[model samples]
Target: MQNDASTHPEGPAASDTPATPDAPVAAFPTTRAKGCPFDPPAELTRLREERPLTRLRYPDGHVGWLATGHAAVRAILGDVRFSSRYELAHVPFDTGFTGELPPAPTGDMTGIDAPEHTRYRRLLAGKFTVRRMRLLTERVEQITTEHLDAMERRGPVVDLMEAYARPIPALMICELLGVPYADQDMFQRHVATSMTLSSSEEERAAAMVAIDEYMRKLVMGKRTTPTDDLLGDLTTSDLTDDELTGIGGFLLGAGLDTTANMIAFGTFALLSNPDQLAALRAEPGLVDQAVEELMRYATIAQTGLRAALEDVEVEGRLIRKGESVALSMEAANRDPARFPDPDRLDLRRKATGHLGFGHGIHQCLGQQLARVEMRVAFPALLTRFPTLRLAAAPEDVPLREGMNIYGVHELPVTWGEAGGA
Candidate 1:
């Protein structure tokens, strides 16, 4: 299937003189201000305003394009001409060690271009259809209630990230992949450590091998017993053991980390905006729109990397073949032309073309599952507790700095004992 990319008109005219080719080179992966935890790095936002498509110098000293505008980023994601091949792309910000890149591991659809990606996506597509996701709603509601109950039992005050945020997606993905909930901690720890950018190469490699081994075991089990779950469903397909294992690893890590952060960050964003929180509480019907607005407002996955397969023209700029491009999804979602008053957190706004779940063939496969989780969980937490607020001072909530995934490291929260609506 041809996934449609977000198509929005170009934003206001480029600033006078445009980021003069003489403009001082700003490092990629710029830092966000502590005071403005919800905003993208000021430098990145400024880059968008000044010249959405400008030069980006990678750590290895390769100068490429950075697409911060809605149109430009979407164009890159939707176009097959830009390669997602693992070895060809440049790491946007890291200044650490360098070497030749290996091909994307089996089943990692994001790392490969067409044909292969098309095959994996086609096989997995039926498993996450809209109907199937909606059918999982009752179970999601049950899971949310169970966690909320646990929080109420252990609370008044708790780290929502630990007690609420991470486990919901963790358990859901485990259930989908036929992973035993008892073993969730093992894979959870591995996935978490793997996401830490500061981790040493040895540490990252170890985590990858550990998770892959665990998935290998699960895939072998499915082959023998073939219980009814996503992994089991795949066991009947023509995929090899390596491919099955890789798919399991990809699905679990992707489903868990991204959705977990979204839940936590979305909660933090809503809590910081009391009026927005109240509006959501008062009007239950607004859940779907509110989810989209929150996603656009606080995109958890910060950036995506793509390398040019061939020279391409994007928004009047000529990107040469083999040059890397960083698609700043955070900035694209906030482009003024796409979203008026782009910085404001307005739940009622029509955030139709936001790049939060991404766009094109690589657009998140499990987005509907995420939407269902948030749509059910958010309201359930607020309505059940009636008095939910942050336990720590807003400024003191530890942010996950320098990580690919953006979110609060710990969300200390308190709520009244009352459980009734």
Candidate 2:
């Protein structure tokens, strides 16, 4: 697998506007606006307003399309004419991998198209269905409760990130994949090394090699032992040991980090938006909508890329073959055409159909699992500590930088005492 990423490809909106020659090529956004941690970069909003689908200049000097309008982005994501294959793509923003990208490795479904992708998707779909994810809710709650109990015992002051947010999804994914929870620390270390732009190519390769070997061992073990996890269940399928290993590694990495960020970053968003928080606390049933709003509001998996396989028109603009389109999921989520009063953090809004998880076929495979985790975990955290507030000022909390996923490095939180939700 090239890299584990979150992608949502859905339908297009009719309002995709054409770009004019004099219009400046949109640059990939790097900074959030001052004082508003929840909103997309101002430049993104401007571009979305002026040219929903505009020219984007990549660092490698390739001129491509930037799809910021909600409709256009969803349309592009859903249209099979745009290939998700890495070999066909150009880096929308410079996150190190430049020039012509290598074809996706075997079993990395995100970077491939059509028949191969269909096969992997077909095999894994049943395991992550809504019914299956709903079943995991009880397990998610147990894991969440364990962490919350730990945090309360430790003290009022804690980095809720490490204490509460990170562990819940990690435990769930580990259990589902039949990976020993004892080895999560090791998995995290290698996964971290593999993801960061600063890590040397050798380090990244070594990390992959280590992960590949470990997964292969796990697959081999499952083959002989046939335990009761996702991997164990898949062992009965016709997939070869190599294919299963690749998938196991992919699922293991893809499952945790994004949901973990949603928990931490979603909390930061709620704390920052007190009115929304108060409203939810007053009526805990809104947790479902609250989770949806938070997904739209925080949008942890911020950006995605796809390339055109054939000449096709999206909105009013023609996308020539071989050209890439850099999708701003954050900007699309905030599109006023699709979302009323787009910038506000209103938990009461029906925030379903959000591109925060992308749309169409490649939409996040574990999104159901994520929603279940967040729906249970967020209310539990809020209820357990009604007075929960950020220990450090929101501005002081360091945001995850240069990474594909958006979140805080740590969330220092404190509460006065237990109270009713």
Candidate 3:
């Protein structure tokens, strides 16, 4: 999550430094070119091209591996020899070396590999199927329209992040998880704290405590009186309340921040590329491909981390036991071999294999829901306001450079009038 400007300059001149065994390579970079915020950092791209699997120096000064190429990234993620266990992972952050990492908390599926992970996945996968998510489309459309209506009434300009991007997913996820949407501010604040790199350890601990306490109470309510929601539906299962609390907390945090950023970042990408925007607005049928391309183009969940359980040969390179590999989905999505003219945002391109939702067993569980939100929200926003455009200059818009998720903190957008370009 470090974007050392001095170490990583903006532009084509970024990755001049070589990645020798002794030299530490940045796991994921926020130092992307200032001129075009959509592209991955030039240094990262150069490394991907030069050495897809190469040596990386961790903040703890231990050496690991960095996976940049699409093939190598997928291999690392899919291979069972590599472990996703939290204790096995080498911390990838820039500061405060925590030499010994803690084990994944109970029900933190992403942190633990199967068959424990299998249990959670099996329990929840049925609920997140395409048909189930699509069933909520009407509600999603209503949410999108309501927000757009608010924006229309508010006038020529508004902060789309707070107004539209954040609320829709917050509401839907709360409904699905049975968390009270009225308490969104508490969880949203927790997400904000965790995503911001500048947040102190104390702040993060407090945020975790707040969200954990809230989830525990919410789970108790589900146990006492089962409602009609994802959490409520799971009350009959044999899983303990502790496990349920962990799962709910994990799902709530995972579902909220991701789709919210996808909306904000996807919109930013569209507004930045007017040609694509024009294409989308002109052809309503292109929504599916547009959403896929945007997911590939602005891979907000930038990096995937895992450590080797044993020596494994991946993409002709050996990753030894206990070594961490930082999978740069941002760089991998933009790999020319996987995506022709990778830098260009071509909506028509078949971005099927892109690492947008990630790959292998741990791919995004809520991708269907995220897709529903984007597919519903984007076109409707464009069609509703033909004149929708960035209210501020491109360079002036705030980017979440320091955080793990890539997006704008606030997107100030404006239109000529309701239904006018």
Candidate 2 clash pair list: 8-358, 8-359, 9-359, 9-360, 10-74, 11-74, 11-75, 12-75, 13-71
Model 2, position 379, has a per-residue lDDT of 89
Q: Where is the poorest 10-residue window by lDDT in model 2?
A: 7-16
Identify the runs in model 2 with alpha carbons over 4 angstroms from their true place: 1-26, 417-421
For model 3, residues 314-392, the per-residue Cα lDDT tens digits are 8777666667778889899999888999899989988998888877889889999999999999999999889888888
Would you list the C-alpha lDDT of every candidate in the order shown? Answer: 0.82, 0.82, 0.82
**Candidate 1 displacement at residue 352 in angstroms:** 0.9
User: Runs in model 1 with CA error above 4 Å?
Assistant: 1-24, 417-421
Looking at model 1, how many pairs of residues clash?
Answer: 0
Indicate the residue-level lDDT of 88 in model 3: 65
> Alpha carbon lDDT of residue 102, candidate 1?
68
How does residue 98 of candidate 2 score in lDDT?
Answer: 46
Q: What lDDT does candidate 1 reach at residue 51?
A: 79
TM-score of 3: 0.92
What's the CA RMSD for each of the models? 6.0, 4.8, 6.0
Q: Which stretches of candidate 3 lie over 4 Å from their true place?
A: 1-29, 417-421
